[model samples]
Target: MNLFHFSDEGSIDVFLPRVKENRKELPPVVWAIDEEHEFTFFFPRSCPRIVYTRSDEMSDEDRRAFFGATQANIVVTVETGWYERIKRSTVYRYRMPAETFELFDTIAGYYISPRTIVPLAVEPYGNLIDRLIARGVEVRFTPNLHPLREAILNSTLTDFGIHKFDNAARA
Candidate 1:
């Protein structure tokens, strides 16, 4: 599981064992910590990365910086799988309530998804992507580049026919 601090300076050492030993995936839990304990949760790229927060509220600049830092820390050579995962699960929790809608709009504005399926149209689906795209979140979408686009294009043109979109609306 990835622990996000959402900070530019702080660090946490997440326990990520080698795949050969442990066959468990990381748990998803967001831990908000006070500055009382010594930070033992720091690790290199070989381990899972944790994102820490610098202040009580995250500003637009902070959000952009945090995304950049995470991308830099978690470096992967491949892209396809990751991109698909993002498209499937791009939801994120934000600090401010009003900004949630704003974030969703931004995500839709940025990534040009060939998949006409508007994720934002779903509940909380559009929130994270919108914020990320609006603030210029630098997530690598190499997996979603060509093949996915082609599949989407082919699907839209011939597979489902022209009325499938309308049919889906009624359902």
Candidate 2:
């Protein structure tokens, strides 16, 4: 399967994992939809947030309020057979698009889109790349720098500097 990740230009050549030493607290291994959507969903610690109509309806103020001050980043694509395996092994919770919502059950972590699945904890993601590599995954990077020149320029998370990884690089 082809999975997509978005990140800043500086990280185009690197894959940064949420390691205990660097993060102190564990974080999820996140990815975005390969295709575009009017709204992009994020589950930062099981609290769902949406970056809605970033290129259209949303105002700059709302963008900053909802997504913070950030610019476009690179998009990463990886081909792996692990998505299903990971999804199946992990327990997930999801939500639909709405203007506002309150968080429930703090431990599940957040997931966007009606059925977007995510693991309950960050532990499995700790060695996600390793598992992907063990399963023979191929990772590739695509830079989303030029707003007028790239397809991903319109992606909701483009300005958020999302990052993706290629396990092959480690080998």
Top model by TM-score, which number?
Answer: 1
Query: Each candidate's root-mean-square deviation in Å?
Result: 20.3, 15.4
In terms of lDDT, model 1 sits at: 0.26
For model 2, name the residue pairs that clash. Answer: 6-162, 6-163, 7-73, 7-74, 7-161, 7-162, 46-109, 46-110
TM-score versus the correct structure, for each prediction: 0.22, 0.20
Q: Model 2, 1-171: lDDT tens per residue?
A: 122332212123323333323234545323223223211211112211212223444456545643344342221242233333333442222222222222321222222222333322221122333433443332222222222222334533334322222222222
Compute the lDDT of residue 26 as modeled in candidate 1.
25
Q: Pick out the ten consecutive residues of candidate 1 with the lowest summed lDDT.
A: 160-169
Which portions of model 2 show Cα errors greater than 4 Å?
1-20, 24-78, 92-157, 161-171
Report the lDDT tens digits of candidate 1 across residue range 32-145: 211121121111112121123233344545446433446442221213333333334423221111211211122112111111121111113333334444443333334223
